[model samples]
Target: MDKINLSVTIAVITMFISLFLSFFLVTVKTEHKLSNRLFAFFLILNAIDISVNLGYFFDIPLNARVFISSIFFLQLPAFYLYVLSVCYADFKLKPKHLIHVSTFLIANLILLPRFYTVSLASKISFLKKSSSMLEIQFNHVLVHIQIILYLIAAFMILRKAKKIYLENYAGASMESLNWLFQFTVALSTFYFIALLKNIFKFTEYPDISESLKIGLFLFELIIIFWYLYKALNNPGLFRNIDSRLKLVADIVSEDKNSAQLIDSEKEYNEDLLKLKSYMMEKRPFLNPSLTIQDVSKDLKIPVRDLSVLINHKLEQHFYDFVNTYRIENAMDILRDVTKSKVTVLEILYEVGFNSKSSFNTAFKKHTGNTPTSYRKSL
Candidate 1:
């Protein structure tokens, strides 16, 4: 296909998929209602982005194209908020969230008199010399600024959320967050390449700029398809972590100079022994959806202290700590001559793992053998 035809075809496909997913996400019944709606808004914004490009391909009127392009300012904000909502269960759309779009509002106000209120002929002439206009250049620079700032914020939230998930819950939570992590990294990479493409457009090589645009279009199409496949396969993947939960490491660093730190250090060995005894006797890891809060409640220990005990004192994440006991439990089962006929799948569930892949991974990590191999070795 010709370059224009190929770009148009890709844009059309991307726009439709985004719209479809936006509708589905909004209408679908899920526990993560806030996250779903925010994600839906992000998808709709993506669809709008595709529509702007498609308008250029079809030679839409300058006035309409200019108006449509204004929405470009909202895309990064929507995506950043979506990331926040997906990561934090307590996330809400407070009025303060409007601050994120201050740039968009400022951009519109800057254009109100210079472009938006101008006559059609003036608007045409303005765009003709837009390459040299200070306001136009400022807006372009502002877009790159938004991309960098929002991408950094989104990544920070995802990183904190992953650490919180690891230190609290065990089961499919990590898998859900892994999908978001991969998606964030992939989207950030796309933005980086698109940034490079935009920079290349200003160079003396028009042919290279055109090739980069085509490559970006193809990359965007592939990303959208990958998202669709992952979303379908992991429909219940929107697990959330409490935003208020602080990591044990963060807590320690913040309190390093406090008297409480000295006291906590004194109790470290006692707390470690107590935690180990509880794990051995209670076998709480047998619960597939176990969380650190459950243990805290059962042991009458403060959640923060319990987190320090498992994560800081034990020198392992709550996930790895719990999985270690689970693997040990599975080992006992594997060594049982009486249970020799039991399948590896059955044994994994019996020992509290929810998925064969995770069970196998944890097993190998702890035992240096797959469950089947461990069983056969015995």
Candidate 2:
């Protein structure tokens, strides 16, 4: 048996953390009840899957290890479902939920002959072969296809949800499912890295696969931190919001600071002025959930016009334009001696940024300094 490494020890700890949190969510009276259950399942599967991987470092029996291979296939499905449940407050899984997980089910059916039908020694051998079994070959293609399709679907769900949320969900306390968006992006990046690792191994790209193990380590950190952060700060994101979220309920108090309205020239130029004025006056950028539609409603301008103003005239997309304003706002606050007592995180929220990464990126992009250093300079 291989000696246990420090990395494996840390991973085991993270695995238990996920397990503990999953149990909490499973038992809690959460907001998004259905979504929370689904997310907890995601966490449980992931924790156990990692546990099984770590098992090889210890004294795990072969039969038990082989039996647990099925959990890996279930992970893709569980992750996809979690994303769906969180993004769609109204989402519920029915008997049809099986279809989303059908690949894992099918994988298990096909893999059964090797993992179960064989002796312990033979089962281990079968698992080691690169492409000797039909099931193994099918798994490669299936996993790649499944990942691409599900990632696209997940991103589409987020895109649509953001659009709809900004348009109608004024009282949601959160403008966008910001944490969930980061979660999706992080999930996608994780898969991409894993796929890359597979490609390197298949292609026998020298020591690339060994280097890619670092990628896997980074992915573990991403999942652990992302899950813990969201689980701590915004438990409601995982709650089964259902019809209870009163989509337009008493417009969550708009920033007392008020949103500015802009004016532009005729045609596209007119859009430019209108968007600029609205941006300046309304400061809609301060709303992390602020979207083109949200700005449209506030400015009484069409979404397309606002898009054109940002895309063509401003030479920036809506996201960048908004971040520009947010970064500038952060700078103003950071430079003020009166606000010196405010923490960086508090200022991030004050300027409509929900995440440190987003705040730091925008801050560094515009000011060429991180939030802390920028403030220190002033």
- TM-scores, all models, native as reference: 0.91, 0.61
Query: Relative to the unseen true structure, what is the C-alpha lDDT of residue 45 in candidate 2, on a scale of 0 to 100?
Result: 81
Q: lDDT (0-100) at residue 272 of candidate 1? A: 73
Model 2 bad stretches (over 4 Å): 1-4, 57-63, 128-130, 172-176, 203-207, 236-378
Q: Say which candidate scores most in lDDT.
A: 1
In order, candidate lDDTs are 0.84, 0.68
Candidate 1 Cα outliers beyond 4 Å, as residue runs: 56-61, 253-257, 262-270, 337-341, 372-378
* Pairs with steric clashes in candidate 1: none
lDDT of 2 by residue, 12-39 (tens): 7778777887887788776667766876
Backbone collisions counted per model: 0, 17
Evaluate residue 131 in candidate 2 and report its C-alpha lDDT on the 0 to 100 scale: 64
